[model samples]
Target: MKGLTDRQQEILDLIKSNLENNGLPPTRADIARTLGFKSPNAAEQHLRAIEKKGFISILAGASRGIILNTEEALGIPVIGLVAAGGPILAQENIEKRIPQAHNILSNKIDYYLRVKGDSMVDVGIYENDLIGVNKKNPIKVGSIVIARIGEEVTVKTLESISSNQVVLKAENSEYSNIEINPEKDEIVFEGTCVGLLRDFS
Candidate 1:
């Protein structure tokens, strides 16, 4: 890949490192504050230069919209919430970042999130476990994921028992399975879980 100028690369490094460590890109003000610039506009100038050089993409009109152009995009999709009555990824209530890997995550997806529920305890994912996800799908069987049903979010293991029915199974018995018919209900698969992380420290 083409290399960036020293200052440009330094700026890029800051943004990339922030996303890697914090699970979200930094805002212009954040970049300026970190680099000790006189104003956020100074950081913005550097970012625009980086974007012009094809090192990153800036989501206009949105705060903290920077995205890395490298493999990090495939690293994880943050689990935000569990769908109603389901045990997996729920779109409506998503709240955190989950880290997975490229091979397991779908392309051009969003960040990962931390899971919160005992429904999936049997699968080794306790409350506060991180789950990765992809935005694109034809989600496969046995994939852990986030789903959206009506207005709630939940986490669960996904199971495809038939051509028309999709099942979301909880890892623990304290929860029940959520079955949906794609042809009738408004249930939607938000993303697939691709990675896991535990904070033991």
Candidate 2:
């Protein structure tokens, strides 16, 4: 909480707002573009200052990587399932965030959603699991992600079979693979699964 100036606070506000709106933190370039900085380095400097103050942490080697200390804020909406094939926030897409973890809920969570299927069981995510998703797109291969195929919201392991072909494969044999031809099917990635919350109690 030290080393941050008023200007840095403004930058933090802007960054927080952007995260709320997009479900992902902004990049150095994005910050620069938004604040009218001459270069991304300027934004980087401010971000470093913010990190030093314990307001955020920058994930090294990751693009647009920034995670706020959630304990400092509250009421981060938990985004549930996204309507596959449409905007992520569509009414049919979002669920509700029930307060569970004080450490997690205290921090600004953009949203929370529950896993409705077992397609990701191979990865240890199961049905009714609460997942924290950052609002963004273009997830990497092998990363567990949430995708929309049409009106249905599904949690699956994302695999890129080809440049234009994506395979949403299930972790269990009981389910089948969903092959998506970007040129044919309206497939869209809502975000990558960052963390999982299961209520064992």
Candidate 3:
């Protein structure tokens, strides 16, 4: 916390909270959106400043690679597939609460969603992985998001948003991108993916 600017301290705290709760570090895009930094580059710059202050370590070529020097424990709810006509965070949908102490990063996580398919495997989100979700962050293009189309829910990257349609792309080539006309289709954004958790056990 020493030698870091106020914003840097805030980002560091977010990194700590994310690590404790989700067991993974937050991506630059996750930090940027949560703190309203306009772009992930701004978050990366702040992360560099925090790293210089000796609070966190940033690893290149990894999205959730920020490492904290200390440890803390916290629990976040893990949601399974959404139940019919129920809210995503409904008690019935919660599979379990996961607690972790690892080098995870991100902003405040609302819950961890248990992935059910291989559509996002190319981005490292595979079936049965638990992805951290933050409902408060602003959704943006290129951000991976948990979306609901009517009664079905899926995770995909937000490719583009136009005045007429929104495009969601799957990370795997086996799946086609989904395009929705806002005026004619019902699309609900549950939350944006901030981090991921995989259980080897």
Best by TM-score: 3
| lDDT values for all models | 0.71, 0.74, 0.85
Tens-place lDDT per residue, model 1, 26-98, is 8888988898997999999998888887778889998888877754544333545444474444455445433
Q: Which candidate wins on lDDT?
A: 3
Separately for all candidates shown, the number of backbone clashes (residues 3 or more apart, or on different chains) is 28, 12, 6
Candidate 3: which pairs clash?
24-104, 24-105, 25-104, 25-105, 26-105, 26-106
Lowest lDDT 10-residue stretch of candidate 1: 97-106
Candidate 2's residue-wise lDDT over 104-176, tens digit each?
Answer: 5333344567877676787788888877776554588887777777666677887665768999878888888
Model 3 ranges off by over 4 Å? 1-74, 100-103
Give the per-residue lDDT digits (tens) of candidate 3, residues 86-172. 898898998877765335754777888999989999999989998889898999999999999988989999999987899999999
Estimate the lDDT of model 3: 0.85
Q: In model 2, where do residues sit more than 4 Å from their true spots? A: 1-74, 80-86, 90-95, 98-109
